[model samples]
Target: MHMLSRPSVLRFDWRPTIRTLPEGQFVAAIGDVHGHDHLLAAMHDAIRRELDELGPRSAAVIHLGDLIDRGPRNREALVRARAGIDGASAITLRGNHEDRLLAYLGGSPAALGPWLDAGGEGMFTQMGLDPWRISPGEFRARFGEDLARWLEATPVMHRIGQLVFVHAGIDPALPLDRQDPHTLMWTRRAWIDSPGPYPEGVAVIHGHIPRRTVDFRDRHRIDLDSGVVNWGILSGLVFHGDRMRLLQVS
Candidate 1:
């Protein structure tokens, strides 16, 4: 059995204007998995233990995406994510890597090179194929087809009350409905640099820009990606009503 290191709690200290989840709901939002299946499994175990302690109530596990590429065990990581943790309904958001994957698999000639350049070739290498030799069709047949379909069908964002979950940050200038899909999967500087209370009461939870720790410095957004592939640690944030806690496994 895997053990989760003791969690660090952060009480919700937002100004009176920020909204929080409804009283009984609980949510665990995980950072980019990046094909770290062992860490994913351990994280799931920790979340199960958490829900058990919380007793019966509404709860969910949201994977912030980038479940594939740049690491070993991409397929296994997807399987574990699809299977979900025992106590929570799992929601997987589509990341930029997934976007590139779909485009490449759909026969977009322009998408292949960029995808490969961004560590996408690692998946093929794991499957015992020369990354350059395998065609997209062959790769899909061996590893993607069903997974691709699932990824295509997954939402880019999910909203639960005041909290909005996305793989990357949203454009601060536009309303949620009007924001472009590409921005949701890839935006960084613009979203991070914006100053002001965004959209009144809504807080965005995302994973894209890797940091040494979960970043809570921003008042309107929370960055959960701790660069798992390079950092050797995977992070998760738990939201129960107005309170939050950080859970991690290395």
Candidate 2:
């Protein structure tokens, strides 16, 4: 297991933090995969080993989303994440990338502009499709039918105990149930630069904006995106009994 201390860039605050999970229960939250299937596969194995070392217990795997686009093995990465540990043990949130792809397939031509530049080129290339000529209707008919359904079905946010897992940050100003889905899958500055934890006091675990490394600085939010497709490492956070462990792979 790779250990990461809190990032030094975090601002000073005096709020109390939860250092561990309840006994016999463990949660591992993975970072943005982009399209690196190898890194994700390694992470899966690492989590399995860690769970084994800890002995028998209830465990949950949470994927921070951004499972597609911007990398060399887009399709494979999506398959790996969707297959997950026994399929039922992991919860995958919906990221903005998935949202954009769904929109493009759902007939919003404008959505394709940003989606393509953000990694759609590589994704389409990997799938052997002509990104320039694939019509939204044809894309959906030929290849997007199942993909659209899966992406559309993904939840924008997932919560367990005191941890709220999301593809992106939440608006700390609103109640958890009242949080806008758009904000849950896209907001950045508002939640990251908040004065403190959410008013509800739950810590958020999210991935969207890429960071050079995992972030565990703020007492309220944990960022796991390590820019894996851009030569940075993929990161994961393991929570058990009040304390947490960091896992990463380049």
Backbone clash pairs for candidate 1 read none
Candidate 1 lDDT over 35-94, as tens digits, reads 888888888887787788776478999999899888787878888888897767989998
Give the deviation of candidate 1 from the true structure as CA RMSD. Answer: 4.0
Model 2: per-residue Cα lDDT over 27-89, one tens digit each: 889989987777788888877877887763688898888888877777777777777774227
Regions more than 4 Å wrong, model 1: 1-19
Best-fitting candidate, measured by TM-score? 1
* Root-mean-square deviation (CA) per prediction: 4.0, 6.1
Q: Largest lDDT belongs to which candidate?
A: 1
How accurate locally is residue 184 in candidate 2, as Cα lDDT from 0 to 100?
86
lDDT of 1 at 73: 76
Which residue pairs come into collision in candidate 2? 19-242, 19-243, 20-241, 20-242, 20-243, 21-241, 21-242
